[model samples]
Target: MKTLRLGPWPAIATLVLSAVTLAGCDDDDDDDTPSDSELATEALLRISRDAPTELPDNVPEDLRRVTFGGTQYDLLELLGRPSGSRPSARIVAAYQTVDTPADPPPLGTPSNAVLPDYTRSAPAAQVYECRQTGGVFAWAFLQPEAGLEPMTTTPVPGLETLGFDHFRYPGGIDYGPPTGTPPVGPAWRVSALALNGGEPTFGQTLFVGAADVTVPNGAGNVPLLRLSNAARIDQGLPSDVFSRTTSDGTQVGYVLRLDTVGGVAPTAGCAGAGDVGKRERVPYSAGYYFVEVLTPP
Candidate 1:
């Protein structure tokens, strides 16, 4: 397996902006503060900060005041860490492009050429009861019932081209599922350390991705490896690596490839001109990691 190490410091401006925003909000309320409608408003502001630049005007007004189990939380608190498999009472938003032609087809004979017009799908909002009591939040995974089976495939259009789908935790790294297997619907992996103490220290997290090893023309199978304290330790290995760019230009680490078969292309390792070091990979995949943290009350 190959491992690449990324330098820690992110872009200055972005870091500064995020710090300022977080600092401003930290003063808004105290842990002992009672829940109020203002909490919802603050949450909305935080969510909007991370949302896409453009949002549909028709989005529900209450989207900013979503509640779980009869309790309302500000958006910053809701999104503070990795959301496990639990369904979000808040709107789980996504954008999709629908292709339509501006001009109709020719009248006489069918024409082969087609013009593509992209339309954004309306945002969707849903409220569910998935919050954990006592301030801790969890990622909920589905359990198979008697005579029922769990779903293993996810429906992602763009990732299919790359032969993998990316799985993300709320406040942690994003991982890729192996090609060929159906995506798992409600499976989640939690940080090992967080499971023990209810709160994970900075730099302590486990990230995982999945791939099907059962394709007819599949590449040689390799066992998924696991690592602890991925961001803080150095494991000597050469592997294919990946990284994600946060809004502030901080690059978060993801994976390192060990070995592969079946002519799959490796993505470029992290690189940029700056004081930051290159990103490195910590190879592993064991479903998803779920971490539940109790909010200060």
Candidate 2:
């Protein structure tokens, strides 16, 4: 089984952005500190921030065998025959379950934050891709629960949660989900560390896309490997995107280029002026797209 590592929580920004100051609300009330509403919002935001990005570490023993490097036989053995699969690409499998459990797990106590009910069954699909070295597993893309609006209520300490309700934040004051459709849904999402050899290298919200990472043929180009540049831009990292097919031609994904960043070397086998690195295939779907970060030399 592949081990996942949870990164330490970086400092979080306050979630309360309302300009309404408690200036004259009650001069008699001298506790100038933030109100319960503000506290509650900040606490919830913190809880969301601290939540895990990959599947729970304690996934039931029955479901634990299904991982990125596991095979199709292993997946079928655990998940049973999938609800649907692609004929062209038998490597892809889709499972429909009414019992999809809450993700990110409920933040039990102290923080006092709770996810809205209804999330237990909010996830409708679980898709997995079978690749050579990576085996059969879903690419860590996050999808929000469709049509489920964020509800406001008194936050509770422990309530079940799902990835959809969890935001894909990219650091800074705006600690929330991306504005447009995210690359992967809640059921299929994975963490940045999960992709980086289980080591925490990027921010909590960074979506790591690999070059030549392919998806099983689905309804459309389901980009199993992808990333978002918003956070990189925010951090002053090189924002130019590029792509290249894996040597075997079995996968296609994106990679970031730091052409302007000094000390970067040219890619082997790839020779083109300013092409720095070959570009990889992108999903047809419209949304924020990015590539994996290249280690600086």
Candidate 3:
């Protein structure tokens, strides 16, 4: 069979643009760590000039096997084709699991009520990144809309096993311990869903207040956003919350974003700064930092 080369696709860029708009920062200020409100206000303050670049020759080949440390070409060979593209960061190959019901089930419904009737849906897409050494593999990511999946009687190493619906690099690997469940109260909710309605999209209005947070417990040592005055316990906001699973099976939820000051630089003890690690301290004079409260489960 002839390999199918993917044409330039903009979906990834759209996703990045939407994300960057939320997390874009202004370096004019020299503050080491700015307040969340300050960053939020600044995010609104700075006008992002990054228009989506013109599409490139983003093509793909037939993917036979996907392995860690494989080249981008190797990935094309395994996944069969590329579905989306971003310049140097990554390429995406999308697979449609099946025609999902217009609505699967209201999130937060009783597991017994929904799980039995629910058919697993394929993740919208698989993101792949190329390494300096010319290898490409599935890149991990967090989806704010992905509802928290509680572990069954048997706990799995990776969160994906529970049908959490987030992306991970090297596939089937958990960053740390799995998040079970979190304490019930002290959560935040959206006053209004979004300007256009439907689940809130990026650049939409986000009204946050202390409410019951519904997402699954986030992994520890992950980068998170927090208000300057927020509590420092549990590594504070923007770091790790619900870092571990409780004996009773509860998962904690925390805010996470893909952008930061210095444009996702490398961190100590992290393979790449992009890897969700510990609370990322904005370097001195790094300017205003922006964060997005992860979407409710």
Candidate 4:
């Protein structure tokens, strides 16, 4: 079968604009009515933007093949054609590990999840703090820490390469964690090298709060999360931490942590007084998709 490329995104946008114009020309008697062209264009736009770049003919084993419907996706593998572009299904299923409970919370997608603007993979550590939970002891989540590199997107030479002193309390206003509270939350940053022979700087910083929704990943693996961020997560906002951001996630509305592997905390160690304050970072990996934006030309 012959493929249709539809030129570039710019051309697609032009088509969508034309469709909107057509919608505006609907009969005045029914101003709310949408023209057929407008409806068709909207559907086409979604299809063209979201269709998988490649089908999931052979799912990699170590990618922690746990998805949110949520189960083994042999059917996806069976239906997928390896050599063709499938502008229909979002072939990359969902993420949440094996350890998720049998009667788990309903699975959900990230807010405003249409099609991602960029997807990056990260091999990371889910940092945990061993502490007393009421009377019993357990491993509590401290943060999901990772040094992000290119996963699904091509590496840009100067995209962001900088030193972010997560420990540095801005302007010497120390809250006194020794490292000064580490900016108040789990953070994701993109750093870029300087072009004009200056020091490298952070391009974007995402400080995310607790998950708005979650899905079980699998046995002995951490759960996948759709963390919320209305551009920024915390209220009052960390002046010291986010002040340096250039984009402030203007292009990125929200992010998805999918296709996970590993990162589950050990249950054995956090069982007693001796384990108090002990920290561990279980190795894990996930694909992160940063989604949709209103970009100006």
Candidate 5:
């Protein structure tokens, strides 16, 4: 079970361009026409990108072992073959851990009394079999497992309404305390989003709104966009709807891009102080909607 690490938040300008480019590319493709294998591969890549930092080591004891349908391949074997010239092309594995601490001891206990505590952890694994063909990397398969359950593609209802076309346990595996357990599967609730689009726009105003769905980490209550007036204008967009202020504040914004998958755009929106205090409003075209999770200090 290999751990997955996500890079820090991408620059605002880069994110905007990437989103525009992806939206454009998606517009050019046929709708809902991806092959079953292609769909599986896409899901695997999403899981890999969003997997947690660590996974439990106790195989069947604390973790489930599932075999994905269609193909069976070990981690070493998947990576041994050449993925291609591009750096994003390759098979990857990711592990996530979910845990919660036991409740605290009662107040009137003796000074020397020992306190009993309950602490437990569970693990989930997702594997991505992908390759870089024609300069763009795409997943060929996705396998997920939990304990000993048979691997199957279990549909998660309403996922598409939330902007996800497919949602599955992958290996027909689900693990956690029997119902009514606190903090159950908190750490294991991994969610991933991927975009394979064209070149991004240099200066554009993009809007992203969350579809009605269960918030991943009980964070649904938090506001989606927290914009600092100052930071907004500093990034080069409109100062009216977004501007800078003397008071220290935080704003919620969506990610514009995660990683570049195709030809790089000639020029991306400006970052740093180049466009500080300047206002620009660009038009938007229809395509795939951009989704990102952001927290500001």
Candidate 6:
């Protein structure tokens, strides 16, 4: 199981940036504090400094399996994609050659399900409350508390975090059922962590509907879920904004909760009316795939 300690981290990020920039400078008396980009890079390096480089034989080369800082992300479900899965975004498919048509269909799994925009590792809790539903007492799912860490790829093995920075978010997974409730509708209060020049940056808040597709993972773990995006929360930002902003990633599509570990509500916890207000926080960790569209824009 993966573990993460959640708390306020601005001070920590600032300290990291200070220490790194100070150590690198000798007497260059221009700028002491690092840029937002530099600070972001340092934070990303610190978090993923301990991931194992080697992957199991079962994992595909197209994907990554990271075990960093005791949080192992074996995205087992994404390993060997189906034959229907393709690399083309729906936009490209929509513009199929009426004038200059390809002799063959574009390469890869042909399904509308293209690869993810990027993946993240979230060690979260599936909060549940014993509420009366259908006149019976049961454990109803509440919101999820998690911190998202962007997964990055390195051209060289040992130099993974050197050039890449995966920003960390002290955030939560806000959920509401697909019927579209008013109060708790947004799916993720968590900042969208998107990559900028190999550095992960925080973007806007993501809105999504709950569980459009649900697949049972196991007896002891939470079910895999697909939460479709509700809006284009982060869109039309300037490319030049990447350097100035802490994050500039557009996130308005789908969120897949694949490769789950735990967080099952107790089957026997709520027995009667007496247990109506009981609460439980089942611990879980999942590999989250964030997709912009059926294909990238």
Task: At residue 18, give the lDDT of candidate 5.
Answer: 39
Least accurate 10 contiguous residues by lDDT in model 2: 232-241
lDDT of 5 by residue, 12-58 (tens): 53343334334434453545444322332233333333332222221
**Regions more than 4 Å wrong, model 5:** 1-17, 20-75, 84-93, 100-188, 191-297
lDDT of 6: 0.38
Q: What number of backbone clashes does candidate 6 have, counting pairs of residues 3 or more apart or in separate chains?
A: 6
Off by over 4 Å in 4: 1-123, 152-183, 195-204, 207-210, 232-252, 293-297
Would you list the C-alpha lDDT of every candidate in the order shown?
A: 0.23, 0.25, 0.22, 0.38, 0.23, 0.38
Name the lDDT value of residue 99 in candidate 3: 20
Model 1 per-residue lDDT tens digits across residues 1-297: 111122332244234334323433444454444222222222222222222322233222232233345676433334443533232211221212111122211110022212111111211111111234345433222121010011112332212111111222122222222211222221111111111222222111122333222212234332321111122110110111112111232222222122222222123332223312332222222221111122222
How does each model score on TM-score?
A: 0.17, 0.23, 0.16, 0.44, 0.16, 0.45
Candidate 2 lDDT for residue 23: 18
lDDT of 6 at 100: 14
| Residue 75 shift from truth in candidate 4, angstroms | 20
Selected candidate, larger lDDT, 1 vs 2: 2
Which candidate's TM-score is highest?
A: 6
- Give the winner by TM-score: 1 or 3: 1
- Residue 215 lDDT, candidate 4, scale 0-100: 76
**In order, what is each prediction's RMSD in angstroms?**
24.9, 20.1, 23.0, 17.3, 27.3, 17.6
Per-residue CA lDDT of model 3 for 1-297, tens digit only, reads: 111122332344343334433443455444445333233322221111111111122311211111223433232232222322211111111111222232332222122111112223432221222222224222332211221232122332222111112211111211123322222221211111111113312122111212221222133222323211111112111121112212232222222221122212222333443543332221211111111111112
2 versus 6: better TM-score goes to? 6
Higher-ranked by lDDT: 5 or 6: 6
Give the per-residue lDDT of model 6 (tens digit) for 192-242: 122232223232223344456677778988876665544322221111111
Q: Distance from true position, residue 202, model 5, in Å?
A: 27
